[model samples]
Target: MASNVSDPAGARRPVIGLTTYLERATQGVWDVRASFLPQQYFDAVTASGGVAVLLPPQPAAQAAASVVLDGLDGLILTGGLDVQPELYGAARHPLTDPARADRDEWELALLAGARERGIPVFGICRGLQLINVAYGGTLHQHLPEALGTERYKIGGGVFAENTVDVDASTKLAGLIGAGPYGVHSYHHQGVDRLGEGLVVTARTDDGLVQAFEAPGDDYLVAVQWHPEENSADRRLFLGLVAAADAYAVSHRGVSA
Candidate 1:
């Protein structure tokens, strides 16, 4: 295999695919469905020595996912709308975001293909929920209702701050340490049932599953908080980039 990314000055910059949101947006004189991601995501990747590739919702197909992953070293399931309840055999929560069937199908396919290819993956917020659901786990749908508190989410597009305790035995603790770690959060749903083959790496005081990792050598970590929101801490991003770099080296692709 050859490097599939451009190598300038003989430096290796792993190509990381960050999933994006496909939503209706408005510009000057236009308002239509568009694909977009926050700049912080790509910035975190590039800052951590990896190239960021925005992967928007596309026609859900295993073949499409395979083709997309063929050129990438890692995959990121980003934060966004809630995962449809039907995905995990649940009913709709009145507060859950409207169904994003296309995104749901597309991301699930990408995750499956990425795992099969032994590619590193990182999930944030909604990403974590999706990963859990992918592994036969379930979500709480509404944290306020389940937890009986609005600590995880505040109104007016504000991010709440929370603390998570990492398990010393898990891989996550190795990266960020095993203790009370402060994090930025803006989500209402969280893991309900532990996913098969997934280890719980962290949790909040309320016993909400805050983080988990898959059982494998390949990098697979997911957290309920929004790490991207806190630009000061890029350890999570760096971990993914480091894994992706190794992946690119072991599984070389065509380099331009």
Candidate 2:
């Protein structure tokens, strides 16, 4: 596989595709649109010398994944609605918010294809939960009921700060450094059982899962917070872009 080297003639920046959300308008119609991510997300990726592409919700998984995988150097699944429990062979919980079925299928397919092709992946908030479910893991659906903590809120208000203990040996620790840093939290669901090949690297003071990384091989990571909401937290995006750049240099574009 030839490396998809950014042609030096033109400032070739690695392209990263960010998953989007679907919204129902007042007109009583569901529209597929690219949700606004904090400006910090773009700044973070741009700071790392990567091009950020906002990916809109696609209707089909195979077609969507093909197009996304072809042009992207990496995939970043942004936070959004809850995932359908039916995806993992479980009944839908009464408290579980309606899932975005289309987004779920598309992202799961995208993540699976990325894994098979060695494409780098970064999962944030709902993205983390999606990765876990896509990889045979389950989510708590509603965090407060499962974890017994109202400390984390996801109601579109100002983000609340929380402490996350980092594992000294993990890549995440290397990125954010040791000790508990203030993280912005805004999610109602969390990983209940981890996906295969993923090891927890960070946890909340209350023992809730905060972050995880791919063990042994692969540049895959998922976090339960919105690092993009903080422009100051460039390390998270840098780490992801760096991994994608390395992977792009290694695998390039050999279609599977």
Candidate 3:
């Protein structure tokens, strides 16, 4: 296979598609029907030596998802709206946000195709929950109700600082730098049942499922916290970029 050298570093930057939220967004003057993604997600990808592409919900995820996957080296299932309880055969929790059916449909298609292709993938807060639901797992739906406290979700755009017990055997621990590192969290819904082929790699002081991965995959990570929320920590994003770079060598695409 031939390689494309379009980047300053003399190699094509890995194309990492980051899923977005379809929402009513406001800019300087007007509100618009937009596919919104936080700057942090983009910054993290770029800072880690990969190109970030925002992927929005389409009319038919099943039809377009494979085409989208064919053009990327990696995927980032980002954080956003709650996963509809019905997705995992559960009753709707009163506190859970109404389902974003379009996003659910689109992202799940992307995930299915990516998994089939062995594409590297990373999942953040809501992303983690979606991963669980994707693999026949369940979510707590509401941590406050289950734990009787809002420790996992301290609102006001605040990032809670908590320690996670990382398993030394997992890739997450090696990439996380130090042991028992404090992470930024913002969700209440957490992984309850272990997804098929998924193993726990990290946990919180309260024993919440903080991170997981597919054991034999080159790169497949899901975290209950938000690494993109804090730009300072580039470890997770760097890991994705590294995996994506390797993926590109095998699944070549146009230079980003």
TM-scores, all models, native as reference: 0.95, 0.87, 0.94
* Better candidate by lDDT, 1 or 2: 1
* Model 1 residue 2 lDDT score: 45
Off by over 4 Å in 2: 1-10, 24-38, 154-156, 253-256
lDDT winner between 1 and 3, please give it: 1
Cα lDDT for residue 175, candidate 1: 87
In angstroms, give how far residue 159 of model 3 lies from its true place. 1.3
Scored by lDDT, model 3 comes in at: 0.86
Please list the C-alpha lDDT of all candidates, in the order they appear: 0.88, 0.80, 0.86
Measured by TM-score, how close is model 2 to the native structure? 0.87
lDDT, model 1, position 129: 94
Best-performing candidate as measured by lDDT: 1
Per-residue lDDT tens digits for candidate 1, residues 127-173, read 99999999999999888889999998896889999999999977798
Best by TM-score: 1
lDDT for each residue of candidate 3 in 1-256, tens digit (9 for 90 to 100): 4222348657667788999987898889999999899899999998988888899999878989978887788899999879999999999988999989999999999999988888899999999999999999999989988778788889898988877888887889878853687788888799888788899999877778999998885689999888987778899999998888887776674434
Give a tens-digit lDDT track for model 2, residues 16-54.
888876554343465543455656667777787788887
State each model's C-alpha RMSD to the native: 1.9, 3.7, 2.3
